[model samples]
Target: MSVKIRLQRHGKKQKPFYWIVAADARSKRDGKYLEKLGTYNPNTNPATIDLNLDQAVQWLHNGAQPTDTAKAILSYKGALLKHHLDGGVRKGALTQEQADAKLAKWLEEKAGKVDTKKEGLSKAQEVAKAKALKAEKEANDKRAAAAVEAAKVEEEVAVEETPEVAAEETPEVVAEVAVEETPEVALEETVAEVAPEETPAAEETSEETEA
Candidate 1:
């Protein structure tokens, strides 16, 4: 019975999650498995993995052939490296203690790199959010200033229109003044006629006296 180490697909569409399994080679892709290794979640930033390193190495040592993608996953998580080191221990080329120390150091370095990437991503998001907020605030302030300027312009237009409206209304007032002075003009004409009559009467009286 040939056993294979592979990933079984799960999770929703587009967002894929997988289970690492040791299963019979003849079984369907989603069928029964011999042993469950762990899980792999690629939706995360660094691609979260929860692998049992000892179990993976054991399966590899037992000749369970891994699929191409699973091989890469195992290689990335240090399972392949541990298996190789164990091989060296079996061949008397290196001690178990030396292999353990090297694996430990490599894992520590990988973890540090993951942490650095996470911190950089977080800082970049914060900067972008702050910049967007500043831009929005500036837009709002510009709109408010434009509205105030428009109001001032409208007020000035109303002030300019007031005098024009009053000028239009003044012609009737001038006509009324002209009509009120007509009676005084008529009285002056009557006085002029009486003066002429008095002049003629004076001339007649002088002649009678002389006679």
Candidate 2:
């Protein structure tokens, strides 16, 4: 049976993760796999790929036909480079030791590049977090300042209103009290004049009755 290298669909709906595998060409897409090569998760920043370089290269040497996506994955993980080195070994163009050295060097370089990318992402995330925090603090300060200003304005309005309310009420109360005192004072003056005239009449009547 002819063999094929392909990806098996897994994970959940709308979020797909995949497994790279070598399987029989006649098998269903997810039914049976000859060997599980590795896993692929595209939900990450760098789109994670954990592939077995040696196994994938072995599968390639055994004439396993890889699907396009699987081939790309193999190429990205240096499996294709290993396959090329194995071919060079077969043709006596290079020794096995040289091939291994070259592969090791390449993997080291790739690892360094991946590390650099991760560091860059980490720094970017830190900067974004700091910026968000600063913005939030600034917004809170503005709100607090606005609250203080509003309180001050309300206090000033209350101060302005208190005097006006007192001024408006005081005059009406004083005028009503003054109007009541004016009537009492007029009646007291009239009673004093009548008392003087009655005293004089009483004295004259007493003198006349005695005589």
Candidate 3:
């Protein structure tokens, strides 16, 4: 039976995880496998993968056909590269020691690149957080300033209304003073008229007595 290298689905819905496996070509996608290779988790920032490089190279040597995704995974983890190096060793084109050295150097460089990517992501997150905080502070400041302005407007309105109330009461005070002065003027006029009538009556009495 022909063998195939493929991924077997696992993990929860919507967050798919997988296991790399070498299995009979006729088996169901997630069924029995000849060997468990490694795991692939796509839920991480830079999709995490763990592979048994030696075992994977051995499978490739034995002519296991890998699916496209499986081939990419093997390539990423350097299994394909190791397989090629082993082929060159078998052909006497490269020594085993040389192959191992090259693979190790490549793996080291790949690790450094991954680390640099992680650092860039971390710095980007910090910048985003700082920007969000600054925006929130600015929004709060605007609200505080608006509240102060509203309070000042209310105070000015109250002050303006105070003068209008005082002006309304001024007419009543003037009316009271006018009423008090009118009564005094009327009494003086009445006293002057009565004195004139009494003087006229005394003159008539004197004339009659003289006659």
Which candidate should be chosen as best, given lDDT against the real structure? 3
Worst 10-residue stretch by lDDT in candidate 3? 169-178
Error of 1 at 70 (Å): 1.6
User: What is candidate 3's local distance difference test score?
Assistant: 0.96
Q: What's each prediction's TM-score?
A: 0.74, 0.79, 0.75
Report the Cα RMSD per candidate.
Answer: 7.0, 5.0, 5.6
lDDT score of residue 156 within candidate 3: 99
Please identify model 3 stretches exceeding 4 Å from their true place. Answer: 165-211
Measured with C-alpha atoms, the lDDT of residue 201 in candidate 2 is 97
Which structure is stronger by TM-score: 1 or 3? 3
Q: State, as a TM-score between 0 and 1, how close model 2 is to the true structure.
A: 0.79
- lDDT (C-alpha, whole model) for all candidates: 0.95, 0.94, 0.96
Rank candidates, TM-score, best first: 2, 3, 1
Q: What are the per-residue Cα lDDT tens digits for candidate 3 across 12-87? A: 9999999999999999998999999999999997889999998999999999999999999999999999999999
The total number of steric clashes, by the backbone 3 Å criterion, in model 2 comes to: 0
Compared with the true structure, what per-residue lDDT tens digits does model 2 show for residues 48-162?
9999888888989999989999988888888999999999999999999999999999989988999999999999999999999999999999999999999999999999999
Leading candidate by TM-score:
2
- Which has the better lDDT: candidate 2, or candidate 3? 3
